[model samples]
Target: MRGDTSNYRDLFLGDVPMMDARAPIEFRKGAFPHTVNLPLMTDSERQKVGTCYTQQGEAAAIALGHRLVSGQVKAERLAAWADFARAHPDGYLYCFRGGLRSQIVQTWLREEAGIAYPRVIGGYKALRGFLLDTLDRALAECGFVVLGGMTGTGKTDVLAQLAHGLDLEGHAHHRGSSFGKRVTGQPAQIDFENGLAVDILKKRHAGHAHFVVEDEGQAIGACSVPVGLHQGMQRYPLVWLEDSFENRVRRILRDYVVNLGAEFVAEHGHEQGQLLFAQRLRQSLDKIQKRLGGLRHQQLAAIMDAALAEQARGGGVEGHRAWIEALLTSYYDPMYRHQRESKAGRIVFSGDEAAVLEYLRRASTMARRPDPGTSA
Candidate 1:
């Protein structure tokens, strides 16, 4: 934190824990991958300091912060920092900008607990900037291939098997569909972007070419893709995988109903988990009700209820296919068809899953080979 502000490797290159000295709300909004929030000031105290800074000045804010966080309160926070430092001796502390808050934490740890550690030099902002720049570079320099398909075509599956694949949906903890929300909450925007950059950099450094990505909207759940990367996807060579409607129905059932339902049960317990899964399905259908139309919506809802009833009785989710049929035939397929019409010109390859995989494998090999004329 003192000498260099550019070495971001210490935080991201390995499994080093970082002590975030920002307030709780700030940390919840967006933070680094491994950062543990251990603030110098509580949210209320920070708010008070912010008010003082606005009303009086920096000097007044500093005085108010010092006054508010003293005696037992100060000792408790310092003790927390000391405990974290003792646990992770190689760890560093960071604030929003490596400014006063971080310096105070660093100074306290050194003087009180005798743990002198460097904080992130430019802090969260700098590290984030580094990742953003990394994404920018990858978009500019790396060849990109966009994998696209109808909703249940398992484009994600095809992407996962390729050496050049970049699983954006997996990174975002989303399937890029209406019912794609995971059991756990999605990562913050910063964490999402950071993970994307790290993945891209790893693949790039390994001399992988044509970063293969799945079709996605600009936003995946709560997070938005970077402009450069999104645009790159739009313009990249497109490979669309096609599958039978029955095959897609089976895949959707396996993914959304069976697998996800089991995961919810594993995480949330039986009764509550069953209710949650049923609720999520109903909600997803409800979300696009207008698109699904009144009669179809009502029909789908009835089928979903029946499916839930069957599932609640400790039976297989084969009944979900009726609703899935109504969904794909009525909702998802139509929407995908419209989008496909628009991007039809961009598609360079279109086939079943097996053909797509073979194409990607061959393409990856071709892209990675050096030209004989240029080779040393």
Candidate 2:
């Protein structure tokens, strides 16, 4: 079954949810969208089984697993899985390699739970492989337009306006910045790649010649963009997003301060939440201290603290503009400029947000038109 794993790739194309039969630790590391964790074994149980297999042998491991999972513990797990299967009739189950773990899940689901749960042929490993291969194919078949801009230029907005735009930051959920951490943390690396690959596959399957994506560094938060896609981005035509510094600052205020503050308050109480938001921003800025140099870092840190203090006293969060503006000018702008220098001669055009959106929409329509070979 593992050898015939091609069918696993198309699972995401429909509304089929996934039931991850791997342990919670494994699922937490990375997972597909619409996946619910229905672990076959607890982490300790898996560890015990692994240790038994290593020290005793496969038969001993099997016996030990049977012993460990019997009675109440076994019944509870089976009940949970049956409940999930009943709800998601079309869902597939998967483990690490579509090996014994997944097979056992399928058998037990049928025999014990009276439910026939179809397991992925090669499990998560095969599905992930398919997505990775799909990404490579997509890059080869499709042309690309790279969106370039400094932080706060609202590049994400441009991507939204464009028909074929791909928001890498949105996929990663980190905004591709030190301070880009969301109230909800970023997805695991494996999940991030799968998400991106699905998008690419959809685009490629639609026969689009190319798509637009942001120019991001390899890493976003804890997740890294797949190497091949990143390379394609480097080689693609670039469109620079230009916005005024003041407008950018206001955008930042709206996002990082106003929007984020409300979310934090909703989660935590008002006072603690504001402090955490302020601290998070400060921590993000502190990460670039070496690049900022000692003096500039100190100056900015002071401004940042004052802004936070003012907010603590119920002053407007717009005071953060002082810190944000300074950080942009001193750190982000120069860093972008250096990177741009490296990207010299690569930029195909530069325009404000509206112009770029208009360009991207037209480009998307052109890209979607029938190819000469396929033309009637």
Candidate 3:
């Protein structure tokens, strides 16, 4: 009781490290940020115990779990937990609901290891609940503004500069497009939600009463915005980010070509990375083939093939511009134009990147100001 805590707010805000004690399967479904899975039971062990519980009751299940985990297995788990405890003395531990498994873990540490590590009061469920509530409350109590633009107008760049900016794409680890997939995979859906909520919580704690987010749809890559936040975003005021078509093309080439190629090479060795990067580009284009239409898609694909080949030979990246220009002109721009038109009523400002960043920062400052009509 002395070390156990229910204070989810400080736990997240302080970036407290935590050890999760749920089974591996449960841990995979969702987890808090900065928390590691040092599961109480492996998937196979958990399944056996679960079956025992369903057929023979709690006493039998407990017996089965002990039998499955005793001796060397138990020693190894205890060592892993002890190592973590020694490494992070202030960290907390938890299971699904701070129930039997975590209680048992706490008891073992105290009795066998002589370490009194704290456990979260309501465990993973409560922490997750706090985050969901954090996001919902922020949507209700805080003012939010959406930054809208065609592809590569650099909405993300502007958001990075604002104090209250929420980079949903950053949280999602995506650029929010067909070509947005990173070499690394996206987080699980629950992890995405938890990350977003934690972000809002920390900002609110820092006294931000408003936020800026990109004009993203329901989904960015494999991650979806929470339903309530997405709905609330639709009604928020919008800022349209603009840039010259040539500049946009150049940006796309730099991001998707030069930079992405470098990322691949850095991740894999040069030969494999270059091969995968080329494949990724072609595959991404193929995914939109129906939308691009047969003739246009083939023409673009040919240009892309030529560009990839040229770059492979150590030619400069200028060749990428041809297909990028064509794709923007034929595909992305028209789609974004329709989206902006539909949401025209919400457009509160429009400008190039510098002007838009200035406007958002100014607006954030105004929002943080106290009302003159209120008492001092």
Over the stretch 1-376, how does candidate 1's per-residue lDDT look in tens digits? 3332356754565646889999998888778777799999889999999999999999999999999999999999999999998898778888988889999998998898887877888887887787777777767666888898998999888888887898988889987888898778888887888888767655665567567898888999988987888877778888899999999999999999999888889999988888888888889889878877899889989999999898888777989999999889878888889988899899999999999999988888777733211110
Over 1-376, each residue of candidate 3 has an lDDT whose tens digit, in order, gives 3579998888998999999999887888889899999988999999999999999999999999989888999999999999999999989999999999999999999999999999999988898888877877777778999999999898888889888999998999888888888888888899999998888887777677878999888999999988988998889999999999888887888888888888889999899999999999999999899999999999999999999999999857899999998899889999999999999999999999999989998888787733211111
Question: Please, what is the whole-model Cα lDDT of each candidate in the order they appear?
Answer: 0.84, 0.81, 0.89
All candidates: TM-score: 0.91, 0.91, 0.96
Q: Between candidates 1 and 3, which one is better according to lDDT?
A: 3
**What order do candidates take by lDDT, descending?**
3, 1, 2
**Predicted structure 2, TM vs. truth:** 0.91
Global lDDT of model 3? 0.89
Native RMSD of candidate 3 (Å)? 2.9
Which candidate achieves the best TM-score against the true structure?
Answer: 3
Per-residue lDDT, model 1, residue 363, is 87
Better of 1 and 3 by TM-score: 3
- Ranking under TM-score, best-scoring first? 3, 1, 2
Clashing pairs in 1: none
For model 3, what is the alpha-carbon lDDT of residue 32? 86
After aligning candidate 1 to the native by TM-score, how far in Å is the CA of 63 from where it should be? 2.5
**lDDT tens readout by residue for model 2, 184-297:** 777888888888877766555555667999988899888888888888888898989899999899888888888887878888888888878877878888887888899998
